[model samples]
Target: MDERKIRVVVAKPGLDGHDRGAKVVARALRDAGMEVVYTGLRQTPEQIVETVLQEDADAVGISILSGAHTFYFTKIIGLLKEKDAGDIIVFGGGVIPDKDIPGLLEAGAGAVFGPGTPTSVCVEWLEKAVADKRAKEQ
Candidate 1:
């Protein structure tokens, strides 16, 4: 990984067994030159947060298809803040409703990718978010 590579943790939290989208997003981030760590399926919010800290990731990308994004996203955001990891850019992709996008952002999601959104879009968002985040930190 490049020293400047944006490290990201891609996770599927809770009982969400559908991971095709998560794996695809992970690959997209990797192809875009980010260092991606795929946490596989069935991660709890706690486990995801722990992995994020251990990896010292620049961002976290979650994919949920079990229709539990609101609960999980809020939980993850709370845990992240508790861990003092609120600086990490949090994003997600899945069958999320359009109305939920705004709320997710309010809850700390930097970006939320809906179904049919292209991989390039995700990459661009991550690239810009990581750059902007690092710039602000410095």
Candidate 2:
């Protein structure tokens, strides 16, 4: 609700060569009036976390299509907590199984979107999530 725009870091982690989904989501977030920083393709959890820190991002949205969502997501979340930056919201999408979603959330993902999720849904979720997070911090 403040004048400052919500900042989100969209990243592709691991050996995933495909980045179409990540790019789409990043553009959608930007179109929704959020400041989106795309970390490009094949990033490590450390690099993504460092970008989050440097950007002072309120949330991180990861796109993983290589079936390593659990490992990469948990690592990123762990690194965030280790660096005392657990307040940053983490969400993910791409090739994620329904059964894996609960585990992902338990591992610290705020939400996970599977195939066919609308961009508006993602934008709305980020808006509310960021607002709630900032409000709580205040």
The TM-score values for the models, in the order shown, are 0.96, 0.98
Residue 114 local lDDT, model 1: 92
lDDT values, one for every candidate: 0.91, 0.94
- What tens-digit string does per-residue lDDT give for candidate 1 at 1-138? 125878999999999899899988889889888889999888999999999999999999989988899999999999999988899989998999999889999998889989999999899988888888888877
Model 2 worst lDDT window (10 residues): 1-10
In terms of TM-score, how similar is model 1 to the real structure? Answer: 0.96
In Å, residue 84's CA in model 1 sits off its true spot by 0.8
Which residue runs does candidate 2 get wrong by more than 4 Å? none
Record all residue pairs in model 1 with backbone atoms less than 3 Å apart, i.e. clashing. Answer: none
Identify the candidate with maximal TM-score.
2
Model 2 agreement with the true structure over 23-114: per-residue lDDT tens digits: 99999999999999999987999999999999999999999998999999999999999999999999989999999999999999999999
